[model samples]
Target: MFLLVLLQVLQPAGAQFCPDLCVCSGGAAELRSVQCGGAGMSALPVNVPPDTVKLRLERTLISRVPRAAFYNLSELRFLWLSYNSVTSVHPSSFVNLKALRELRLDGNLLTSFPWEGLRDMPRLQTLGLNNNRLSSLPAHAALFLPNITYLDLSSNRLTILPAELLDLWFPLPELQKGPVRRKILGLHDNPWLCDCQLSMLTSLSSSLGSPVVLMDQLLMCSRSMAPSGMLLTRAELSRCTRPSVQPAATRVVSPLGSNVILRCDASGYPTPTLTWIRTSAYTDCCQQNLLQNSEQPPRILESFMQGSPRVGVRWSIITLNGLSYQDAGEYRCQARNMAGTSEAPIKLKVMGVTRLSRFPKRKPKKTPFKSSPKFRKPNQTLPEKESPFIFPPLKNKIQKV
Candidate 1:
């Protein structure tokens, strides 16, 4: 009895630390790795051994990561939660992962990440966020992930990236130094807008002694007047250009009490801001003279603007509601950027109201119907059709030996 009890105590300490539905591997005294997966897991496993160095929990139904989820796993070096349905993670979910070097959340449903949480993982080097639904990142995201050497952001809905982040990867001449290891940045398969910003990335990538490696895939951008699949390395994007406006129509005619939408699209590097100004000449001499003054500005009309940096395009629309004679004027869409400013004019003319007549509803006349002789009834039985190229049955010829 004493011998059996001693054997049970000496069996394995790592096995006892394993959480339910998880498999652990390590020496007899400590657990180093724990892996938990399958459709049955709906939440993160608790009570992971404090000494565990690696943990993988993938392909589960885990939708959210609660705060301090891994508070005790201080020695963890790698944590992968790929292919999960995780949509959100609390800012403090990675609280105690100080020694962590690699963290992967690929193939998740995350639309936004808590970049502030990176403070907890100070020693992290490799970060994987590929195959997610992220469309944008905060401007200051580069501050927290400064030391990251291997970054994966491919296959996301990213259209534009902050210049600060790009600067981090491709430092200025004065800031560049001999890196301990070559940095790898994966940015392909994104809808990058071909602007001066993207042009800077391409130019940096082509530098003779750059330390960063953009994966071996051509980065493409969406641009007006360009082919559907244009590569970013084109010479057109090599330099910054002034902003230019493309108006849908130069003149608009609308009836009184009706609404009309005037659209203006602008393109340039350093994405431009569009403004709508009501520049119609005023009747009062003082006002007209003031408007003519170069220093004086016209009245700015209320408008809606949307910009897609990924496509290097910004558009603005102003709606003239309840068009009246007083609303007739020339509106100017002024697009301004660091490069230069450009304007496009739209002239609106409102005419007297003309009433439209409503036609009365008419019902169809009922008529007696007869079936065509060529049409067959649903329940009618037809003669059997012969099969084409039918083979005849062979007779069994017995050969007497």
Candidate 2:
């Protein structure tokens, strides 16, 4: 057999150009690449290989990722820029990385999701964006990341999950194949409003032995029987979605100087929860102060929409501070244990004015001091009145002070 040698192009400059973007140690022979994560780079660093397989820029100061940031990096497989101060992931940011497999972008400042930016990575397998400030997932957010198997979405501020999340097939259909099922799901640590709208998540929990596990346990309930709190375990959550066993009505009552009480009167396999929250500015009062557990309340929150269909997450008030307007806002009553949280929202409106009345002055009865009864002189001889003794003119005038 003839001996064969494999020749690889060597670049001496790769060792010298390791700036704050990455730190390369040893010589080029042992160094595969450089990673400059959290380097505070304003833009992509200089001297990075176009074909580098792994690039980590997490927690960096890079605000604007240019379109050509990774131009011609056909061999690039892994790119991590999570926890950076990045506000936006520009459109076409990752268009050239067709071979990318894993991308980590959790813990960044993304107001709206970048749906289009991720479509170009056809081979991307794992994506992480767990801890961000996303109130709601965009409709069909999973379409862009179809190939993702492992997703991390813990520790975010998500009030209402998209209805599409119920249609799990649409988001990730590819994971259904192969002998080893693609383990694809991550939804803990989100402030999931435990309501009828989220009944689907409760239902799904039953089909799977557990709430599909993907991320860590950092979920907080945005609306529940209580103020902000964490959600319960998966098994209990499944029982919460079962159909009612009794037909009931929600009753709300206000108590004297204590927290309000929200009650639910729905019949289901397990009793549901009652929770509340402040209305969002985008919605009118009719939509605001809504029942967190019910899609709609049996009555309009303010009776403005009286004819509207009745849903059943009831509210009762236990007013604190004599019930003043300042105490008015939104409150959530959440009921959750091993089962996931179920909640309802009640808006407290101090009906009529809430002012204290001055105490009434008590009338004084005319209590006549009755004259002592005049009785005839006792049978015994009345003491004889002594003859009036006449005193003389008197002593000398008292001396003046």
TM-score winner: 1
lDDT of 2 by residue, 12-118 (tens): 44434455557655444542455787555767775555546777786678776767567656677888887787777777788789988998877787666666777
> How much lDDT does candidate 2 score?
0.52
Worst 10 residues of 2 by lDDT: 1-10
Off by over 4 Å in 2: 1-21, 25-31, 38-40, 169-180, 196-199, 202-211, 224-227, 230-401
* Model 2 residue 350 lDDT score: 37
Error of 1 at 199 (Å): 1.9
lDDT of 1 at 372: 39
Q: Model-by-model lDDT, in order? A: 0.77, 0.52
Clashing pairs in 1: 193-310
The regions of model 1 sitting more than 4 angstroms off are 1-15, 28-31, 176-181, 224-226, 241-401
What's model 1's lDDT at 91? Answer: 89
Error of 2 at 113 (Å): 2.5
